[model samples]
Target chain A: MKHQRWLPWVFLAPTALGMGLFTLIPIVASIVLAFFQWDIITPPKFVGFANFATVATDSTVQVSFLNTIVFVIVAVALQLGISLGLAVLLTEKLPNWLRSFFRSAFFFPLVLSAASVSVFMKYLFNEKFGVVNWLLSLINVPAVPWLTSPAGSAVVIILVYVWQNFGFSFLLFLGGLASIPTETYEAASLDGATGWRKLVQITLPLLSPTTLVASVMAIISALQVFDQPYVLTGGGPGDSTRSAVMVIFETAFQRLEFGQGAALGVILTIIIMLITALQFRLSKRFVFYQ
Target chain B: MTTTLEPRRTASPRTRPAARRRRIDWGMTGRITVLVITAVFVIGPVLWTLSTSLRLPSEAFSLPPSFLPLHPDFTSYAQVFQQLNMALLVLNSALVTGIVALGQMGTAALAGYAFAQLEFKGKKALFSVILATMMVPLQVTIVPVFLLIRGMGLSDTLLALILPALPTAFGTFLMRQYFLGLPPDLAEAAAIDGATPWRTFRSVYAPLAMPGLAIVGILAFNYHWNEFFRPLILTISEQNFTLPLGLVSLQGNMGTGSISVVLAGVILSMIPAFIVFIFGQRTLRTGLTSGLGK
Candidate 1:
C-alpha cells in the first residue's frame, strides 16, 4: 500500500520537478523582481513602486499599450468572425472536395512561422515591386506604405495576426459545429426558419462555449503579439506599432534595465489575469458547453 | 441553434417563388464570392514569396516583376548554405526541437496519465493549477527566463531554448484529457502482469495514446521551430542561431530590394514546417478539434 501510494507521487515527480524549476520559480522571481532595480550584473536593490510608476508614465509605453489594445480589438474581432463563418460553411455538408481545399488553404498560414510570414509579407508589400502594390496599381490606386508608416505597419501586423490565428478559431468552431445535432436543423427547416434569422437563432447560440473560449484566447494572444511586429516593424515608424511586450523586451535586454522590464511584465500579467478571469466568469452566463 | 433556423426560413414552401430563387442565388453566389476574395487577400502575399524564391537574381527585382520565375534558380538556397551554414542551423533546430518535444511529451504524458488514471490527494487542486498556468501569458516569464539562462551560462547554447520548453502545462492538460477516455482496466491489467510504471507507460499506455502524442509533438515542433524571441535574446553567436534568427540576420545583409535572397530565406525556412504540415495535416486538425476536453 505504501509503495502504491508512492506511485502517484512518482508519476507526478517529473512534471512537478520540471514545473518547480522552470515554471513556478521563474513566475515567482519575475513577480518579486518587479519591486527591485537591477541591471543583471549589479546587485538588485529594493526600489519599491518606482519602476511601476516609471513604466506607467512613460510615453512610449503608453503608445505601445494603445497599439496593443487596437491590435487585439481589431484582429480578434476580424479573426473570430471569419473563422465562425468558415466553420459554419464547411460543416454544412458541403462538397467534400471543396471543404478539403478550403480547409487546407485556410490553415496553410497557421503552419508557417511568423518570421517567415513577415518576410513573405515584406516582399508582397514592397513599394516598388510588391505584388500587392502591383495589384493595387492595376486598380489605379496608389501604393500604400505598408511596413514603413505607423498606421500602415499596424494594419499589416493586424492582418498577419488575423491570418495566422483564425485557423485555430476555425478549428474550434468546426468542432462546435460538429457537435450540433442534425435533428435540430431538420426541425428548424420544418418550421420554415432560414438564413440570418436561422443563424442567429441556432448556430450563434449553440456555438457560445467555443466562441467564449476562442475569444478569450484570441484576446490573450493579441496582447502577447511579439514576433510579427518585432520582425516586420520592430515597433517602428515612430513607436506606432510597438506593443506592450515589445516595450518589456526592449527595456529588459536592449536597455539592460532588468527590473523595469520585470515591472512592466508584471503589470501586463496582472491585467491579463484580470481580463481572462473576467472572461471566464462572464462565460458562465452565455456558454452552453455540451 | 441559429443554423437550425436557416434552411427552414429560406427554403420554406410558403415563400414566394421569385424571392426564394433570389435568396438561393444570393446565398450561393454571395458566400462563394466573399470566400474567394478573402482567400486571395489571405494567400496573395505568401504565394508571392514562393514565386520570388524561385526567381533568378535578375528576374527577382525587375520592374513590372515576373509573377513566375521563367528560369527558376535554386541558387539562393545554395547561398543559404554557402553564406550562413544553413544546413548547420537546420541541424541545430532539429536537435533542439526534437529534444524539447520529447522532453515535454514525456513530462506531459506521465503527469497526464496520473491526472487521468490515478487518484491521489490534491489531484483536483494540482490539475487546476496546471490549467491555471495555461492562462498565464508566456510573455510575463521571458525576462526572468532570460535572466535564469544567462546566470546558468547557457545563453549561447541550445540548452537554453530546450530546457525552458520541457515544462508545458498545456501539453499536460491535453494529454490528461485524451487519456481520460481510455478504460482503467488496461492499466490495471498491466499492473497485474508485473510491469513497472515506466515500463507499463512505455509499452502499454504510450501506444494507446500515440495519436495524442503526435498532436502534442506536432504542435510543440511548430511552436519551437517558429519561435523567434527566445532565440533572439538567448543565442549570441551566428553559428548557434536557429533558422528564424539566421533569417533575420540574412535579411539584414540583403537589405530591402534584394527580394531574391530575402524571399529565398523565407522560402527555405518554411520548408520544414510545411513538409511536417503536409504529412501531419489530418492529425493536426483532428487533434486540435478533439484535443480540448471532450
Candidate 2:
C-alpha cells in the first residue's frame, strides 16, 4: 500500500471530535462549574470552595453518599454470589438445550429496561395489593411495607438491582469457567478430591481472574445505580433509597443547584475513581492470572 | 457436563439400571431442585406482570393471584393507549435510539479500523484514553452535557438525548477488538495489488466487518433504548420522552390509576427489548463476552 498521510486521521475524526465535544468537554465544564454558583436563569458567579463546603455539609448529600456505598457493597456481593452460584450449576451435567435454556432464562432480565423492571417490581412488592404480601400471607407471615419503610426499601433496592444484574456476572463467570481445563480437575479427582474440596482447591483458584473482572465490573456499575430506587422508592421514607446519582439529578435539575450538583458530581467521580483504583491495587495480591 | 456424566456412562453392564437410579442421588436431586427453583424465581415476576396485565383492573389484586388469566381482558391496554401518546413515545424513542445506534456504528467502525490496522502516532495513548472514559459515569458529566446541549440550541428536544450519546467508549473498544481479530492477509493481499489505504479499507475490510458493525449497532440500540438518566435530565416535554421515561410517569400516576393499567404500560415497554433479545441474543452474548480481554 502506498503511504497515506491522513487516512488514519480521517478515520479517527468523528470519534475524536464527538468524544471531545461531549465527554471530554463536559468533564472539564463540570469541574469548572463546581466553582461557580448559577441557577439556570442566573448569571454565573464565582463561589470558590463554597459550593463544595455546602455540599459536604448537606445532610441529604451525605446520606446519599452513604447509601450509595452501602448499596455498592450489598448489590455487588449478591450479584457476584448469585451469578457465580448459577454459573457453577450450569457447568454441571445437563442436556444441551436445558443448559442454554437456563442460561437465557437468567440472562433475560439483563435485556429489559431497568425503569420498566423497577415499575413492575414496585407492583410486585406493594404492601397491600402486591403479590409479595399475598404470598407471604399464604405462608402465615405479615404484610411488609416494602416501599414505605427505610430498611424494607433498602432490601427491595438490593433485590431488584441484583435480579437485573447478576446475569452479567454470570456470563463472565461462565466464560471464566469454560476456560478451565478439565485435566486439572481430573488430576484433583485422582488425588481423591471430590465436591467441596475440589471446588475450593482447584475451581476457585483457577476462576480467580474471572472473579476479579466480574466483581470489578459489577461493583463499578452498582455504585452508580439510579433507576431502581429512583422509580421504585423515589428516595422515599426520608432519603432512604436515594442514590448518589439521584442526588445529582435532584440538585442540578429539580432544585436547580447546578454548582452544588457539580460539586457532588466531582466528589462522586473521585470516590468512584478511588474505589476502582483501590480494587486494582488489591488485585495485585488476590487476582490469580494464568 | 462430561465430568458429571462420566461415571454413570462408564458404569459396568449390570450397573446400568443402577445408573438410572443415580439420577435420584442427593447431589443430582439437589442440583435439579436448585435449578428448577431458580428458574422459577428468575422468570416468575415477569409472568406475574403479564398475568396481572391481562386480568380485569378490578381483579388486579385478586387473592392468590392466578398465573393463568381465566378471562383475558384488554381494558388496561386500552387505557394505556388512551392515557399516553403511545405512538409519539415510540417515534421519539425510535428516532433517538435508531440514529444513535447508526452513528455509533459509523464512528466505532472507522476509528476501530484505524486503531486496528492503520499506522499512526499516539495510537496507544489515544485508545487508552478512550477506554478510560468508560469510568466517568454519565451522572458526573450530565449536568454540563445538558448545558452543552442548551448551548447548541438543542435544549428540551430529543436531540439532547441522541447527541451526547453518539460518542461511545465501549462500542469503539468492541469494534476495535473485532477488527483486530480479522485475518491480516486481507489487507496484505490488497496491498500487494497496489491498492491505496482507502481502497484497502473500502473494498477489502469494510465488507467483512459487518458482523462487528452489527455488534456495535445492536449494543447501542439495546443500551440507548433503555437509557433513563440522560433522557430524564435532557428531555422535558411529554412528546420528547422515551419509553422508559414515559413509563415512569405511568408508574407515577399510581395514586389514581389501576395497577393493571400501570403494569400494562410496563409490559408494553418491554416488547421492543424482548424482541431484540430473541433475535439478537447470540449477538448480544458475543458482544458482551468478547469485550473482555483474553
Candidate 3:
C-alpha cells in the first residue's frame, strides 16, 4: 500500500476536531471560568479564588454537595445490590426463554428517560392519594409523607433513581456471571458447598471486577443526579433534595452567575475525578480480574 | 481464605446426578417467584402511567388503581396535542436525535477505523484522550460549552444541541472493538487486488462494518432522544425543546393540566424509545455489555 500519510488524518479530523472544540477546550475554559466573575452579558473579570470562596461557604452549595454524596452512596449501593442479586438468581439453569424474559424484565427501565420516570413517580408517591401509601395501608402501615417531608422526599428520590438505574448494573452483572465458567460452579457443588457458601466464597469474588466497574459508573452518575430531584421534589421541602448539578444549573442559567456555577461545576468535577481515581486505586487492592 | 476454598481431594470431577438437578427445587421456584415480584415493582409504575393516561382525569386516582386501561379513552392524548405543540416537539427531537446519531456513527467509524487498522504517531495517546473525555461530566463543560455556542451564534438553536454531541468517545471505542473483531483477510484481499486503502475502506471494509455502525447509531439515538440536561441548558424556547424538556415543562404546568393529561405527555415521549427497544434490543445489549467490557 502507498504511504498516504494524510489519509488517516483525514478520517481522524472530524472526531479529533469536534472533541477538541466541544469537549477538551470547554473543559479548559470551564476551569479558567471558575476563577473569573462574569455574567454572559458582561466581560469576565478576574476574581482569583473569590468565586471559589463564596461557593465553598454558600450554605445551599454546601448542603447540595452533602446531599449528592449521600445520594451516591445509597443509590449505588441499592443499584449494585439489587442487580447482583437478580443476576445471580438468573444464573441458575433455567429454560432459555425464561432467562431471556428475566433479562428483558430487569433491563426494561434503562430504556425510559429519567425525566419522564420522575414525572410519573411524583404522582405515585403523592402524599394524599398514591399507590405507594395505598399499598402500605394494606399491610396496616399508615400513610407516609412521601413527597411532603424531607426524609420522605429523599427516600423517594433514591427509590425512583434506583428503580430506573438498577437495570444497567443488572445487565453488566449478567454478562459477568455468564462469563464465569460453569465448571467452577460444578466444582463448588461437588465439594458440598451450600448455595450460600458458594455465593460468598466463589461468586462474589469472581464478580468483584464487574462490581468495581458498575459501582464506579453508578457513583459518578449518581453524584451528578439532577433530573430526579429536579422533577420530583423540585429540590424542595427546602434544599433537602437539591444536588450539585442543580446548583450549577440554577446558578448559571437561572441566576446568571456564570462564575459561581462554573466554580460549583469545577468542585463537582474535581470530586468526580478524585472519586474515580480513588476507585481505581482501591480496585488495585480488591478487583479480581478473571 | 485459601483453607476454606481448598478443593476436597476425594471430590469427583463428574457432573452431579441428572435427576437431582431435574427435581423441581422449591428454593429455585421461590427465587423465580421473588424475581417475578421484583419485576412487577420495577415495571408496574410505567404500566400505571400508561393506564392512567388512557382514562379520564377523574378516574386517575380511583382506589385499587387500575393497572389496565380498560374502557380506554383517547381524550387525554387529544388533550396533550391540544395544549402542547406535539408535532413540533417530536419533529425537533427527531431532527436533533437523528442528526446526532448519524454524525456520531460517521465520526466514530472514521476515527475507530484509523485506530484499528492504520498505524499513526501518537495513536495510543490519542485514543486515551478520547476515552478520557468520558470522565468529564456534561455539567462540568456545559457552562463553557454554552459560551462557545454563543460564540458560534448558535445559542438556543437545535444546532446547539446537535453539534457539540457529535463526537462520542464511547462510540469510537465500540466501533474500534467491532472493527478489531472483523477478520483481517477482507482488507488483505482488497490489497491483493491492488486496491488503495481509501478504495478498500470504501468498497470492502465499510459494508462489513454496517452492523457495528447500527449499534453506534442506535445507542446514540437512544441517548440523544431522551437527553434533557443539554437541551435544558442549550434550548430555551418552546419551539426548540425536545421531548424530555417538553415533558418537564408539562409537569411544571400541572396546576392547569390534569394528572392524566400530564401522564399522557409522558407516554407519548416514550413511544419512539419503546419502539427502538423492541427492534434494537440485541444491538443495544451487545453495545452496552461489551461497551463496558474494558
Best candidate (score: TM-score): 2
lDDT score at residue B219, model 2, on the 0-100 scale: 88
lDDT of 2 by residue, B51-142 (tens): 99999988888787787998899899998888887778889989999999999998898899898988888999999999989889887788
Query: A81 in model 2: Cα distance from truth in Å?
Result: 0.8
**C-alpha-based local distance difference test score of model 2:** 0.87
Residue A191's lDDT in candidate 1: 96
lDDT of 3 by residue, A20-117 (tens): 99999988988899999899788989999998897657899889989999989998989999999999988887788988887887778888899989
Top candidate (DockQ): 2
Per-prediction TM-score, please? 0.93, 0.95, 0.94
Rank by TM-score, highest first.
2, 3, 1
DockQ of 1: 0.59
Instruction: Supply the TM-score of chain A against the true chain A for every candidate structure.
Output: 0.95, 0.97, 0.96
DockQ of 2: 0.74
**Ranking 2 against 3 by lDDT, winner:** 3
Expressed as tens digits, the lDDT of each residue in A1-290 for candidate 2 is: 33576878999999999999999988999999999998979899999999889756789988998999999988898899989998998897777998999899999998889999998999899898888999899889999999999999999999999989988899999999999999988898899997789888888888988888888788879888999999889997998889999998899999998988998899889988898789889988987778
